[model samples]
Target: MGHLSTHVLDTTAGRPAAGVAIELRRLGADGSSEPVASTVTNADGRTDGPLLEGASLQAGTYELLFHVGAYFARTGAGPEQPFLDVVPVRFGVTDPAARYHVPLVVTPWSYSTYRGS
Candidate 1:
């Protein structure tokens, strides 16, 4: 019954980071990374479906890669030299029966994330 989800908010613009590209990757047993799913943020800056569905949810280390640089550039929020290029948030899933919500609040110069409901 484990589930994974995420949301992104552009704090500088006071709105959701719409159209942002996100990649969900799982850490393989061989210490390499594998893509689990890829998605784009909706107008609400959230995935329309569960990031990890069905048997994909497991107890392990995973990464959420946020393409902040491209988002900023497309939105014209920052110049060519953006503060954050690719933001990678890594965390552990200790329980396969639990639901994980990783929410990211980001700006041109900074970003933060936390476990959400």
Candidate 2:
């Protein structure tokens, strides 16, 4: 079945953005968001386990919300007025048998993401 995972890297610090909060959400039929799961990045800037694993995954739209602002502030990498705040990356999952890896590379001012293996 489909699985979801993510990793975070702090481009500004040139390291992992550890202890960052992340939320996984599924889009509801009525066009609203529903929480599927929530997790915080580990010291390696990765989820302790799959965000959504085994039969929990379904083919649909999903969103990963990263709390970059708070992470940067807490880590003393940037001030409250950092360039980037909350960053939301959304993508569609079409294959239930596939593994989906969404990796985020971010700094206080910018970020990037791509479908990873």
Candidate 3:
């Protein structure tokens, strides 16, 4: 069955972005969304388990919210007012049995994401 996972890398520090807050939400067709999961990255910059898996994962649109500002604040990095705060990555799941790994490579000033293994 399909499952979802994520990782965060602190490009500025050249290491995993530990302690970053993350939220997963399933988006509805009516511009509404419901929370699916919430977690913080561990030292390895990954969630302890797949965010969504098996029967719980369906073919649909979803959003992953990364709290970059809070992470920088807690780590004592970045400017007082970070240019990039909460980064929202929205994507669609086309196959129910495929694994989706969305990883974030970020700094206080910028961020990027792509579909990974």
Full-model lDDT for every candidate: 0.91, 0.91, 0.95
Per-candidate clash tally: 0, 0, 0
RMSD of 3: 0.6
Steric clash count of candidate 2: 0
lDDT of 3 by residue, 30-77 (tens): 999999999999999999999999999999999999999999988888
TM-score of each: 0.95, 0.94, 0.98
State the lDDT of candidate 1 residue by residue for 5-103, as single tens digits.
999999989999999999999997799998998999999999898898457788999999999999999999976898898899999988878899998
Maximum-TM-score candidate: 3
lDDT minimum window of 10 residues, candidate 1: 49-58
* Alpha-carbon deviation at 22 in model 3, angstroms: 0.4
Cα error, candidate 1, residue 39 (Å): 0.4
lDDT of 3: 0.95
Off by over 4 Å in 2: none
